[model samples]
Target: MTSAPPRVLTVAGSDSGGGAGIQADLKAMLANGVHGMSVLTAITAQNSLGVQGAWELPAEQVEAQFRSVVDDIGVDAVKTGMLASADMVRVVAALLRTLPPEVPVVVDPVAVSKHGDALLGAEAMEAVRSEVVPLATVLTPNLTELGPVAGVELRTVQDRELAAKILLDAGASWVLVKGGHDGGDTAVDVLHGPGTRQEFSAPRADNRHTHGTGCTLASTIASYLARGYDVPSAVGAAKQYISGAIANGFALGGGIGPVDHAWQFRGSGQ
Candidate 1:
């Protein structure tokens, strides 16, 4: 028999809308050719419009789910999103510390949903900045997330680099600063790590169906890492993948829709 596909595990909240959080992460992982697993941190009552309700899982439950996956199936890489509280962040961080150092961890510092729904609380933000963030192998933070995590409002290219530097100093081995909110003709994302810096740019797709772009991008990166790609290559490929996904995005509900995860295998070959 052939060997199993690389496995990528996501620890995050579940989006009932199936557009973001754990749902999007798993979809992205599968699209990127990895076996996806999840430890649901919270259950969300959400739709295209926004998140209506959210209930965090008990820390014990989160631990159990994580242990069940890592202790048995094991993980080649990990990604995190929408941790509901500071306690949850700490718990996940501690667990991540126990993983093999070779396993890359992509941390999507998800603070708010595309519809402006607050997914992470203020108190939890501190925990992310102090605990969860420092453990990231590759920290993927969009414009809005970069500001809160790095303690600076990023507007210009210089500002974005400054924010990335702050995150790098904070302990992530690398930082990918997403510039989707820059309102430009080109969508740009910068990847920065020790003695290395690169920018990946794609023509901005004028699509409003971009609800889960952040989660999808981060998950794609983690999946690539699980497949044995290095950080720069993983981030570059994920950028291209997400660019195509955004272009292929289609409207679903009355509100924002999600990025198309399967654009590559849909015959167009992306």
Candidate 2:
């Protein structure tokens, strides 16, 4: 008989393109040997190129979905993305408070997509910064996402580190500042927190089909966290996973395609 797998729950949106949102989160979780579960908060009409349209689910439905899962199977770790509205963020935050503090929580404060499409609304910003982020064990934000939270411009590597610090100060126990979008020969991602700050640099992959990198990385970290890895180790492993995924990214539907989530399965399409 097969043994049970680690359970990682993702509360996010769906991307029709399968590059980002819940699709990417589940792929990352399953790719890392975890049982993937979901509570979808929204759905996007998206493709490789861009998000054409998005609609958020009612807050009641979001809460019901969360209750359905957490009240039963339970989650080893919980990851959130694209709450979409202030009311939804508040609802999720309240639900998180009801969970035992030992359950790891990863909050991917997703603000915009790689293609510059707005995912979260302006009203949700205050809710996220005040209510949701404080409840997170870790917060993942790209450089572009840092500008709004850090309350400063992040045009350089130093700025990226500072942004991570600012996010940590606000509430997150840990902050991962993704630098994949930063233009350079080498890509740098930073993780900052209480005791120390570490930086990782990998040679930039010249791959345009690198959609979903951020979501994949955050969920990968949450997957690792669910499996009992420490914060630093989980972040390091997730960084390696995302970098490799970017290198092996494959083309899909029209527009920028998604990174190969099952990179380890290779071209076999497992």
Candidate 3:
């Protein structure tokens, strides 16, 4: 019998648009040859335009979901995004602390959507900075979202590396500071902490259908981690995967769309 694929769990919010949040995380996991699982922290009324509404799941429900999965299916790695509230962040952090610390955790502290919708509140930002990031195996934050969590205002690529340093100092074993939001010819992401310092650069794909790029990157990284790849290698491969996902992304709605997660499935063997 064929064995099941490695499992990767994402504890995040639901994106109704199916572009970002848990939807994108699961898709990326599957594309990278992993079994995907989720523990949703909130439900987002998201669209290509923006997030219209959001409802956070009760802390009890979040804990129940975590226990249900970790107690049975058991994940090799996990990625987190969009906790929605301070209480939710704290709850997830506590639960994660009880897990085997060796299980890699990719924390994507999603503060805002690609369409500029506010996904995280100001109060919750502090919780993420203080509680969530401390347990992260690798913290992936976009340039716009980096300041609150990493506490470094960025103006250039050098600034982004400094921001990564701040997050590493904050307790993450590694920091992957995404430089896509910064206007540039290359989309750069840097990972540095402990004994690993890795940098990824891809020539800008010039695609507007970039709504869920951040989610895809973090999920891909976690999936690789689940498969037993080390931090630098995992981040490097994920960078390549997401860049191609962006290059071939298809437009679906009037506003921003999502990356093409299944690109590797195309073409006959050569």
Candidate 4:
């Protein structure tokens, strides 16, 4: 038998729409050449339009899924998304703490859906800040999510950098403040870490069906990290991967659709 490929685990909710959350993470991971696993934290009655209803799983179930995967298959990296409640956030953080120090963890602070529907509870904000942020190897947050977590309104790139600093200081080894909501000809994402900063700008894809951009980017980063890329290199590679995915996004339903995670393979006949 051949050797196993690098493994990455995503701890997130299930998106029934298959545009974001665990579905997106797995797709991104596979696109970037890693075996993806998941620990489902919640189930959402979501579609292209918006999230209709959501049910958070018991904390014990979440923990059990995590343990069952890690104890047997093992993992090279991990990414996290929508933990519905404060209890779930704490539980996920505690589970992350049990991982080896070297395993990279990418946390996508997914507070809301692409259509502006809330995915995380307001009560979970503090739990995420106090418990989850610190455990993250790389924290990925869009401007709206960053504003609340960093307690500031971001209007410029400088503001984003400052917000990134706040998250970095909160204990995340690196913080990527996404500029997708900034609305410009260029989409600039700022990655800030200890004594280092990098700006990754991609031609803002003129596409509206970019529903899974956040989850895809975070999982791509985790996938690259699992492939042994350094933090900066991993993030840089993920930026390129996501830009392509966004540029190739296609309409799925009546509302927004998903980025094509298999964009690279589309015309290659793979």
Per-residue alpha-carbon lDDT of candidate 3 for residues 170-194, written as tens digits (9 for 90 to 100): 7888888887976779988877888
> What is the lDDT of every predicted structure here?
0.91, 0.86, 0.88, 0.91
Write model 1 residue lDDT over 96-156, tens digit each, in one string: 9999988899999999889998777778887898897788999998888888888887667
TM-score of 4: 0.97
| TM-score-superior candidate, 1 or 3 | 1
> What would the TM-scores of all predictions be?
0.96, 0.95, 0.95, 0.97
Give a tens-digit lDDT track for model 2, residues 145-227: 77775667877767777777777888899887877777889998877878878887889988888888888988999999999
* Clash number by candidate, in order: 0, 3, 0, 0
User: Which 10-residue window of candidate 1 scores lowest in summed lDDT?
Assistant: 261-270
lDDT of 3: 0.88
Model 1 CA deviation exceeding 4 Å by range: none
Clashing pairs in 1: none
The runs of at least 3 residues in candidate 2 whose Cα sits more than 4 Å from the true structure, single-residue gaps closed, are 155-158, 267-270
Q: For this target, which candidate reaches the highest lDDT against the unseen true structure?
A: 4
**Across residues 178-219, which tens digit of lDDT does each residue of candidate 4 receive?**
889987799998889989888999999888989999999999
- The weakest ten consecutive residues by lDDT in model 4 span 261-270
